[model samples]
Target: MELLLGQSETQVEYDRAGTIIKGQEVILPKRKHEDVHVNNHTSVWGLWWKDHQWAYKCCQQTIRNTYCTGSAGIEAAEAALDFIMKTY
Candidate 1:
């Protein structure tokens, strides 16, 4: 299964009930390993929205040791992604 959601070019879609239909919601989109640009730093690991809060998942690299919520999730993910891109 695809662990990541969202795309930079695509608009997120919701259901008739006003809820995001499963994996359609954008948390952090899947990104490839690239050394040239900072924006393209993320790898297969991703952040997601769960239980009305933000959570992160690590695959080849770890982003956080514990749970992250709200803006912290985004911040942690960005830092981790940059680190992974540089170090891994």
Candidate 2:
């Protein structure tokens, strides 16, 4: 995904006076771990799946004054999957 550092071309409508903001786009790397057998004593660790890779970007805006906020690139894609699986 590409990161855009300016106001969105399309304005968002809001019911309240507060501004509607958009987060930056980020591309997270995909990772996979090897599985371990319960009977095998040689394996020190077990395989695990990560919801999303870690990536971050910073943004700044000037309204009455300049303000800053941090954003993560990875999408909230794992939320639904985790909820369905009942995983913490």
Best by lDDT: 1
* Per-residue lDDT of candidate 2, residues 3-51 (tens digit): 5665467645544765544443345855434332222222213221233
Clashing pairs in 2: none
Candidate 2 segments whose C-alpha is farther than 4 A from its true place: 1-8, 17-45, 48-88
User: Least accurate stretch of 10 residues (summed lDDT) in model 2?
Assistant: 55-64
Q: What is the C-alpha lDDT of each candidate?
A: 0.48, 0.33
| lDDT agreement of model 2 with the native | 0.33
